[model samples]
Each structure stands twice: as structure tokens, then as C-alpha cells.
Target: MTDRAFRNLDNLRASASTARVLNLLRVSHEHGRTDGWRAAPLFENSTLNRCLVIKHRLRRNEIDAFRVRRYVATKIILPIDGSDLRVGGRYIFVDQVGFDAMLEQALGIGPSHPDRKILALIDELPSLDPFLLREQLRRNGHAPDPCYFNVSEADLMRMSDFVASEITPLVDLSIGPDADLAAENPVARLTAKIMSNSAGEDMSALGQTLMLRPEEYEEGVFCWKGFLYYKWALQTITGDIGWVVDSVRRVKPRGRVDTEQHVAIDRAKEQVRRRILITCEATADMLRVYDDAFRGLTREGRPTAFRDFLRDAPILFARLGERLGAIQHIVSFWKYRMTGDRSAPGAEELLDLLADFETSLSGRERPDVLALAA
Candidate 1:
């Protein structure tokens, strides 16, 4: 990613929807008003100051509603570094009615609230056609009704209703005391709907499209997923490296004559550490590219550009896996030298598998590697 792209992402992170609301509230509260708004600075650097700062006055009847929204925003909205950031199902943090009122307050009295233009853009979303609105939800794998897929008047109306009755509530769940509204909130219902729709069903092409080409506002959903996957892979590799390093230590005898064996074990451990670090750096570079690609391409709502990312991911993973597989082979060689243990966990089986695979690739028998596998 270029320096310009990093700047763009930094700008996006600064003006995230929840962050914008929080910043507005924070700036508003700075003026010696006791309206109960407070700023909770989330992250700060030389170039960025992301904050949560949206603790507003809680009405007697509004506590439950506020708690839920606060929880969802903290859990979903804040972690998403950039993008509009939406939460679904039980995670909907702010309802339209409460949000509109808050915005009115923020815009009305807060002279210093930053990024009014971005706030205006977020506000403009609601006025767009419900069809276009629903399409955004559907594109994010949020599962808007399939009936809204067409352009008929009836379908458009259905889309409108779905937007009003379904999407809006999920987008913001701060709707205060209404005797007519169910005690069972829209969050619970939306959560149930997502679970039911996803169960035992192959993802539709629409769903795949959504995953591949997430909307700018929905980039949070995919970025979080990628973050989790990246963390898990890193943790697994770390664990494997730790175990190998420790074992090498245990095998290194405390004598001067066995220096050759000790040196070999130490070298193996160091090699593993070096190789894994290089792979991790490569992975970080890939993640930067991934982040920039989604943030830049999806800004224009073009999903086709996303397919390249999908292609790049597997190629990257395959190279990492191949490197790790080679590391495993080296570990097994050192392990056998130390312990004289041929059955070194999966070492024997992995060698056999690789030997067969290489033979298939060569379309002929290679006796050297075949003998080693045996």
C-alpha cells in the first residue's frame, strides 16, 4: 500500500460512523454542559485521534435501550478501524429515532464537533431510495428478503418496508419506550433470522458476492473476520515454533564433546524462528494490501475488483504452508538425530506424503527422496 492509501485509511478510521457520533458528543460535552455526554478517547497517535465519547444523558425509561446500543457499538463498531461500521441482529446499537435526536443535539449546540461533512454524509444515507438501501444490506450478507431483488412497484414497496421495519432497527436500536413495540427487541429477532437463514444452506451467489466485494460501510464485517483468521494462524505457528525451540533446548547436552549435536539443535531452532518471522512479516504485508484493496475498491461499490483479493489469499497461504512444511521437515531431521526416534509425531507420514506428491509431479520415481521417506 502507498503512503496515500495509508493516509486515506487513517482518515476513514478517524471518521467511522460511531467515532463521528462519539466525537460530536465529546466536543459537545467540552463546553461545560452537564448533558451527560463524555469523551472516551479510544486511540491517539500523531495523525489520528479515535474516540468513543458518546455517553449521553440516560432517561429513566431509556437505560435498557442505551445499554444494548453501547454494548454493540463497543463490541462491533469501535473495533472496526475504518468504514461506516454496521452491527446486525442482536448487535444493532443505535435506532434511527434516538440517533436522529442525538444528531440534532450534536449539530444544534456543538460548534466544535469535527467532520460535519462526514456526519452529513452518514445522515444522507437514510434519504436514499429504500431499494438502494436494502441492496446495501443484502450486499453485506445481511440477508434482506429475496423478494426485494426486482424493480416492480410492489417489490420496491416491500424493499421500503424492509428498510424501515427491518434494516433501520438493526442499524440503530435506540428506540426508546414504546408500548406498541414488542418487549422482545428487534435485535433478538434479527439474530434469530440470521441464524435461521444461514443454517444448512449453501451460500447464494449474492452471499458470495457480498463476502468478496463488501460495501465500504460493511468493510468492518470482513476486516474483523480477517483479523480473527490472521490471529489464529499466527498463534498456531507460534505454538509450533515454541515447542520445537523448547525441545531443542532439552536435547542440547551440557558437555563440550557433544558440541556438534548441540550446535545442530541450536541452529535448527534458530532457523525455525528466522523462517517463521519472515513468513509473519510477509503475512503482515499481505494484510496491509488486503485492507487497502477493500477500503479503496468497495468505496465505489464495485465487487468485481474483490475477486483478485480472493485469488491472492490462497496463493499467499499456499506459499506459507509450503515454507512451514519445509520447516517441519528440518525439525524432524534434527529431532531424529537427537532422540533416534523415527516415529517423530507426523514427521514420518508427512515425508511419505511429500515423497509421493513429488513423484507424481515429476511423473517418474526419484530414488533419493524415496529412500529418505522409507
Candidate 2:
């Protein structure tokens, strides 16, 4: 059997098709053993290919049958590496969501269950110093280098034993019989929907809803789902409005302010506002910009652009009402405070605002319509 397997390995090397089969078998055998299966070749396609190759090569040999049998046994113990075992393709990190799902399956946890999260598994490593662990593994004849630390595909199979021991029981408890039906889970369904729709028209529609009005903010846009959506223009209020007015006084002094120049100024302010608002910053920073813009407005022989901006403010709010209603409400509340609007929105009013925004999105527009409207 050893001799036969060895001869088969050699024959596999000689023919690309047979080699592929043999290599595949070797990988399966290796993987099975790594996963704590019996450490022997399981008769799979690669193994059969290896055997066929050997049979073809040795058919003309005049060796006695007994000797051939002995040779086969020896060959099995020393089979050569086949092409199938090589790692030649690219590797990709599984999506974070998928990785979390796999972990739950292996560890018997739910997505929201904090006790069995990946962080818990990571924390379970022996608290021994890394230096000590490296030394111990090395003393046991394992090369404990960075290469060993790196988790390869082969390593993943090998580690499956550890995973099975620690994780399988937990998963069994968490999932029960229903675990077999991953397709029915709402989270899984949502994840699939999000992935598929990430580059679609919904993203653009969402973006358009977030845009700011020229009077209230600035003129900037963001691209989502392959389309550009206009965003609130806080940038103009903070950056361009002051500078443009000052520049106009210096450049054209008494001449009528250029409409093109005013537009450019508004555009600059819009860009700045979007950057500042969308950033993950504390509320105070946003308030500062709001306060400054308001203060600046108090001094104006208000530019026509500013008045036009106020006229279009409702449109911006309506669109923003559609994209991120919660955020828009926060902005609206703040805007009201800045403008000294006495009436405060109630909780039900906030919910209604959000509901109305969601309702508007029900009629999905064509990509072209969304792009043009945006």
C-alpha cells in the first residue's frame, strides 16, 4: 500500500489532472487530521487519482506480486506532496458580521449576548506572559515565531479542534434545533439586505435627505449608493459667509455683488458645514458653529444668497426629515433655540416627524430620478 501510494504520488505529479485530484485528497486528509479526525488518508478523489496514477505507471514492471505489495506499504508511509496542497490564492477576511455569526455557531452565543462574545474567547487565553508561552512552545520543539502566530488557513483547520472543544457546546445550548435554520433569522436577513443594497439607490436617497439649506447651512453633497446626495451646508455659515462678505467689500467695494461670487461663497460655506456636522464630535462644537453663524447674521445687510437660502430652508429640512430624522430633529431643536422659536416639539411630534420621513422613502425612485432630484 505504501509503495502503491508513493508510485501514485509520482504519477500524479506527471499529469496535471491527476495531480490536482491527488493534491485535493492530501488537503482533505491534512485538514481532517488537523480537526482531530483519524490521522489517515480517507479515500477521496485525490487519493483515487493517486492510486490510478500508480497503477498506470507500474503496470509494465515485472516485480513479483509479493514485492509489489511490500513496496506499496512503504510508499503509503512516505507519499510525496501534491499540487492540491499548495496555497496559491488570495485570502479575504470574512465580513465582521459573518465572523460574528461563525463565532456564535462555534461558541453557542447570540449576537447581543455579551457573556459569550468574541472578546470573551480572546480573554480566555492563558494569562501567562507571551514571552513565557513562546519559550515553552519552543522547548517542546515547535518553532514559536511570528509565522507560527499568524493564523493561516491550515492553522484555522488545526485550531478547529480547540474551537470544537470550547465552542460547540455553547453553540448547541444557544441555537438548539432552530440553529440549523440560519436563513430564517431576522438579523441574517437584514445583514443580507444591507450588503446587497449598500451600493443601490436607497443610499443616494438617504444622502439627499441629509442636505442642508443655504440660509440655514451651506451647499455640499455626499455620494451614496452610486449617487450624490446634498447635505446641510454648515460650512458656509462658519467659513465662507464672513470671508466672502469681507472679500466682496475689498474686491468690488461699491459695485453690485456678483451673483456668481455670492453663489461660490454659499457653496464654500455649505462644504464647511457638512464636514463639521457629520463628524463625530461633541455637541458643544456644533453649538459653537450655530452660535457664530447666528451672531454673524445679526450684522448683515443680508446677502441675497442668504435670503434665497432661507426661502429654500423648508426644502432642505423636508429632505433631511427623510434621511436621518433623529439627527434632523436634533438640528431642528437647536435651530429653534437659535432662532428663539417659542414652541417646543413634543415626543409624539418627534415620532410623527420620523414616521413621515420613513413614509416618503416607501416610493423607491429610479436611480436617474434620485440623481437628478438630488
Candidate 3:
């Protein structure tokens, strides 16, 4: 469907009560002064921050109806970049309910759960890109309603397009010239409903097209979609990533640092750069496994290799999302925090940012890359 029709369908989905804490930019400056909570524009970087950042004053320990918004560089679905930097969801970080009626109208915030684990799952990763979120839900085995996703057709098309261009040539050859199954299909409709709910009965259209069983359709096809996204993500950042690497080495902090601080910052910058290259190279290598598997399906008409690859791919997402999220975080946050007329932060802040980036890229051993993507 067209954007207009997709929006019409999006409008019909369920909504939650008036959201109070979400509209961080629009809240009255005076309304929360009595309490320690403060609401202000997330950034003075132009007028639009695309996200709402609320900070609080006393009792900082997590408690009482608050949320944590995971910062992201690019939202996979909406493809936000350049200026738009919408942060993620919330938690018990708040102590007051300033105005509950006025905050729910934002473009993305929606229904929430009470479980802290669930909330962490929502905010932990840098981006809640639906394709990965879908995988997260299935593996964790938490079943929420489809309205939980709150996705529009245009948003769903991002995954559809990625799969078409990168994953499923069978989708094109089996159908018509159109490889894109994203256009107003029942599968897309249900997937849009709950990105995690890709196991819809409507899998027939795609499954039959591929001549696969329901089991294969559920596991193999969905994993294919996720891998294709990771491939696109690696390429998109390949050109821009160097700027972040160089900036880390060259960008000077506004304040001087003691030897410990200076040495730590230097260590962090080098480590971040080195690991970023290693992780990215490792990621490209893993993607080649998918590429080879897909080749068997599309070229050799052999589904076994593809199906086997899907079973093994989930181990990779935790690594992919963490590493890519950090990379995307540094690049996008650097653009938001460092570029333009925004003044540079002190050396301490730089160290903190680099440390965080380094931590995210840690833990995964280099994959046994066949390097077919090379």
C-alpha cells in the first residue's frame, strides 16, 4: 500500500492513555519546578531533537514510574539520520506524574509493560529496530499483542525492501518482476502488527513461493531478513565510519586532563578504533555465511544450506546488535554532539563516551569468517 493507506491502517491500531513523560520538549517549564523533575528541549542543536530527554534531581536510584530511553544513531525502520535522533523507551526513573494527559501524542511512544526485564529488553539495545525486536521477542518467548509494535506500512517497507534487495531472490523469480513482498500483503500486514509475530498463518504466500515448510518459513525466512539488514547496516556505515574513527583520534577535549585521565582517553580512543575495525570486519565475515547460504537457495535451488544457516544465526544478533549499536551510537552521537556549532565537551566526557563505545564492542570472539563477502 501507499504511505497514505499505510498511515490509515496505522491509525486503526490501539493506543494507550495520554502519555505524560514522552513529550519532553513541550512540557511546561514551570509545571515541574515544584518537584525536582526538569523538562527542557533535548538539544539546542537547531530546534528539532526528534527525541525527548528528561533529567531529574534527587534520589537518582531507579524507582517510581520512570523510563530509560536508549540513545540511537539511526532508527532502522524509519531510517532516521542527519538531524533526527529519537531516543528509546522509559522505566521507573521518575517520582512524579506532572501531566499525564498531554504526553501521549508523539510519533512513536506506545503501550508498555510492567516487567523491568521487558523494559530493559526495550531500552537495552541502541535501537529497537523491529526486525531484531521480533527476534528478541521470539527467543525470549514473551508474547505480547500485535498492537505492541505500533508500526506503519512505510516502516514495515524498510524490512521488506532490505529482504528483497539482499535476501530473497526467490521472492522475485517465483512471483513476477516484483521481488518486493512488502507491498500490502497479508504477511506484511501481520508482521507490521507484531514484528516478532512473523510466524503468521499467512506465511503460506512466502513459504509456498519458496517451497518450504511452515517451520522453515518461520525460522529460515525470518533469519534471512535479519541478516540482510545487518548487511545493509554494514555497508551504510562503511563510508561514514571512518569519520568517527578519525574524529576520535583528532577531536580535542576542551579541558586538560591529568596523566591518568589523558592516558585513559588515549587508550580508549585507540582501543575503540581498533575494535571497531575488527568487529566490523568480523561482521562482514559473518554476513558472508548468509550470502553463501542464500546462493545455494537462489542458484543451486538447494534449501538445506539456507535452512541450516538460519538455525545458527541467532547467536550472532546479540553480537551484531551490540557492536553495530555502539558504532551507530558513536557516529550518530558524534554528529549530534560534536558537529555543527555545538561546543566540544570536556576531556572527561570524551573518555566516558569512548569507554562506553569500547565496552559495547567487547566480549565477542572473532567469528570463523569464510569471508565470502570480501
Predictions: Cα RMSD each: 25.0, 31.4, 12.7
Best by lDDT: 3
TM-scores for every predicted model:
0.27, 0.14, 0.59
**What is the C-alpha lDDT profile of model 1 across 183-256, one tens digit per residue?**
65554444333323121123234336646433432333333233323433344455565665566444433334
Candidate number with greatest TM-score: 3
Whole-model Cα lDDT of every candidate shown, in order: 0.34, 0.29, 0.50
Q: Is 1 or 2 the stronger prediction by lDDT?
A: 1
Flag regions of model 1 displaced more than 4 Å. 1-231, 236-251, 254-257, 295-305, 323-374
Order of the predicted models by lDDT, top scorer first = 3, 1, 2
lDDT of 3 by residue, 228-331 (tens): 66676677678778888888889777877788887888888899889888877777777777888778877787776766677677766666655565566566
Give residue 6's lDDT in candidate 1 (0 to 100). Answer: 22
| Candidate 3 segments whose C-alpha is farther than 4 A from its true place | 1-114, 123-126, 146-163, 171-212, 368-374
Q: What's the CA error at residue 209 for candidate 1, in Å? A: 6.2
At residue 183, candidate 3 shows an lDDT of 66
- For candidate 2, write residues 1-374 as lDDT tens digits: 12333334443433422101223233343454353223332221233222221111111132233221211110112233444323222111112224346534543545565423322322222211222222333334443222212122432344334333322332333355357645655333322222231323422332233343432231111111001011122321334334433432232112344666555444543433343243313222322332333233333332332233333333332223222222222233334332455443333332233232223222211122122122
